[model samples]
Target: MATLLGAGPGIVAAGARRTMTRCDGLASVSSSSHGIERVYLSAEHARVNRTVAGWMREIGMTTRVDAAGNLVGRLERATPSGAPDLDAPALVVGSHLDTVPDAGRYDGVVGVLMGLEAVRMLREPGPDGTGWRSPLPFALEVIAFADEEGTRFGRALLGSSAVAGAWDPGWWSLADDGGTTLHEAFVAFGLDPARVGEAARRPEELVGYLEAHIEQGPELDERGESLAVVSSIASARRFQIVVEGEARHAGGTPYDRRRDALLGASEAALAVERVCRAEHHVIGTVGRLETFPGAVNVVPGEARLSLDLRGELDDARDRVWRSIEREVDTIMGRRGLRWRSAEVHRAPAVFCAPLLQDVVREGIVSTLDRGVDDPATIFSRAGHDAMAIGAVTDVGMLFLRNPDGISHHPDEEVSAGDVARGTRALAEAVLQLAADRG
Candidate 1:
C-alpha cells in the first residue's frame, strides 16, 4: 500500500509542525481571552472563515461559503482554468469548524486543518512552484462545517444537515441563550434562510465523503495505536424528564407520606447508570438536573433532568431506553409521583461504507511500523458532522488518537507525530479512492 502511493514513505517533511502551528493560529479566534470558544454564526466564526479561505487559495482551491455558512474549497482540475463546476463529481473531505464552549484546540479544528494539509500533499507543484494540481479522477472539495458543536444554537449539525439535504425548517425558530432565533442569526450572518436549500448537494455530483477527526475516547490510546478506521458512529437519543409531586413542609411531612420529586429524579438517574452499564457500548448520562421550589425549608415539588443515551446499534439502544423508562416509572409510581418525558433529539447509528473503511485501513497501515500488524478499528462514541452527512452519501472517518480519550475540553490533546501520520494517511486514502474509481 505504501508503494501504491506517489509519496511512498516517511513523514510529509515538517508537515506536522506546520499543521500544529496552524492549529495554534486558529485557537486565537476564540471568543474568550482565556481559551478557545468559537461558535456558530459568530464574529469568531466569520474571522476563521476568512483566514481559512486564504489558506485554501494558497493550495489553488477556489473557495465559497454555502448558504448554511459552511466554508467550501474546491480543487478541481477538470477545468483548465481551475474554476469550480458545481456539477462536477467530487470526493468531499470535511470536518466542522465550530467548537464547544471553552473547547479543546484539536477536536474539530485539527480535522479541518489536516484535511487542508492532505489536499496540499496530494497536489503536484505547478511550474515555478506558484500553485498546485491534482491528478485524480474526481474533483476534491474540503468543507468546514459551521455548527457541529451546536454550542450556540443547542442543535447540532446545522451546516452538514443542509448539505445532506436533511435541513428542517422547524429549526429556524430555535433561539439561543441571547434570545436570537436561528433564522435571525442566519440573516445577521449574511445568509438568507430561504436560500439555504441551495446549499444541498446532489447525490450524483458526489463521489463520496471522508472526514478525519481526533478519537474522542481512550480505545486507540489504550491500545497504543495512533490512527484507526472508524467502523461506525453511535446512535443517540436525548430526552428531558420531569417529575411532579406536591410541595410540602420539609420537616412537617412524615417520611411515609412525603412524595418527593427530587428523590424520584435522583433514583431515576441512578437507574439509568445501572441499566445502561449492563449493555456494551451503551452510555446514559444525566448531565443537567434542576429541582424546583427555592426555599430550603420546602420540599421540591418538581424536578427536571436531561438524558443522553447512545449505543452502537439502534435496536440495542431502543431496548436500553425502554428499560430506563420502566425503571423511571417504577421509581415515580412507588414515590406517589407523576412523571413525563419529552424527546429533544434522536440520531441513528451510521456505519462506514466498506470501501471507504478498507481504504482508511490501508492508509493507516502505510504509516505504521511493520512490527505491529493490523491497524486499529474503532467505533466513534461521540457524534460528529459525519453523522448528518451520512444521510446523503457514502461517509467514513479516520480517528486519530486523542490522549486520555477526552474531548470538548481545553485539555484534549493530539501529538505532532500523530498529525503527520494522520495527514499522510488521509491523503493516501483520497488517492486510493481515485485509483479504485478509475
Candidate 2:
C-alpha cells in the first residue's frame, strides 16, 4: 500500500479534501436541520441541484436541469461554450443526489462530487501543457441524479431510469407520504410529466458511464483495501408480506387457542434469515414489520412485513425467494395463520462491461505506488444508478472503502486519502476509456 504514484497525487488528494468540504456544505441543505434528509423534487433537492450546478460551472461546464429533474453538466469537446450542439459522443460520470432519511453525507454524494473533482483535475493544462484546459476526445458530462433513493416515491432509480429510457407510466400514480402523486409533484416542481421522455438519452449519445462510489459494506474495510473494482450490481426482489390470524383476548386465550400474527411473522423472518444464510451469495432481510391492533394486551390479528432479497445472480436470487416463500407458508400453516405476499419491486442483475472493468482495475492499480497489479473486484449487493444507466451504455464503477462499511446512516465514512486515490482512479479510467474508444 504505497502512496498513490502518478501525476500530482498530492495535489489531487488536496482537491479531494475540498470535495469533502463541499460534501459537508451540501449536507446542510437537508430536510432535517440536524441531519441529512434530501429527497426527490423537494425544496432541498432543488437547492442542492442549484448549488451543485454552480460548482459545475466553476470548472467551465454548462449545466442544465433535465426533464426528470436530474442536474446535468456537460463539457462538450471542441466547444468552449459547452453548448448542446457538439458532434462528439459523451463519457458520462454521475451518481444520485437524493438520500434516505437521516442519511450519511457520503453515500451517493461522494460520487457526484468525486466526478466533478476528477473532471476538474483532467481539465488542467492539456497535452501540450500550453493551455488551462484541452478538450477530451469525447464530451464529458457529470450528472447528479435527483432520485436514486426512491424515498419519496417508493420506486428506486427514477432519475437514472428515466435517463436510461425505462420510465414507467404507472409511476405517475405513485404517491408520497404527503399524498402527492409523482405526476402532481412533477408539475409542482415545474417539470411536465408529459416531457419526462425528453430526458431519455439515446445509446449512441454516449461513450460509456463511470462512477466512483463508497462501498456500503465492510469487505473493503476488513480487507484494508483503499479501492475495489465493481464486478456487478446485484439482482433484487422486494415484497410486502401479510400474515393473518384471528384476534383473541390476551388473558382468556389459552396457549392452544392463541393465534398470534406477530409471532408468526417473527418466525417467518427468522426462517428467511436461516434459509438465506445457508445459501452462498444470497441475503434476505425483513426490513419492516407491523402488527394490526397495536395494543399492550390485545392479540394481533394481522402482521405486515417487508422483505428485501438480493443475490449475485438472478436465478439464485429467485431460487432463494421461492425457498423463503415455501418456508413462510410452512411457518404460517403450523401456526394456524393465512399468509400472502405481493411483489413491490424487482431489478435484474447488471454485469460490468469487461473492457470498462479492466480500465477501472488498471486505474486503481496505477494509483498504487507499485504494490499490487490486481485489485479485488466486489459484487455489489446494493443497487446503484449504474444499474439503471447500464441499460443505455457500457457502465463501470470504482468502490472506495467505507470504514466499517456502514452507509445510509450518519456513521458512513471514507478518508481523504481514499478520496484522493478514488478520484484519480476514476479520472484515469475515463481517460483509458477515451483512448480505447479512439
Top-lDDT structure, candidate number: 2
Scored against the true structure, residue 156 in model 2 reaches a CA lDDT of 93
lDDT of 2 by residue, 368-422 (tens): 7676687889999999999999999999989999998999999889999999889
What TM-score do all the candidates reach, one by one? 0.95, 0.95
lDDT comparing candidate 2 with the true structure: 0.89
Give the alpha carbon lDDT tens digit for every residue of 100-142 in model 1: 8888888888888888888887775424453334477788999
- Candidate 2 weakest ten by summed lDDT: 125-134
For each candidate, the alpha-carbon lDDT, in order, equals: 0.88, 0.89
Residue 264 alpha-carbon offset, candidate 1, angstroms? 0.9
- The RMSD of every model to the true structure, in order and in angstroms, is 2.4, 2.7
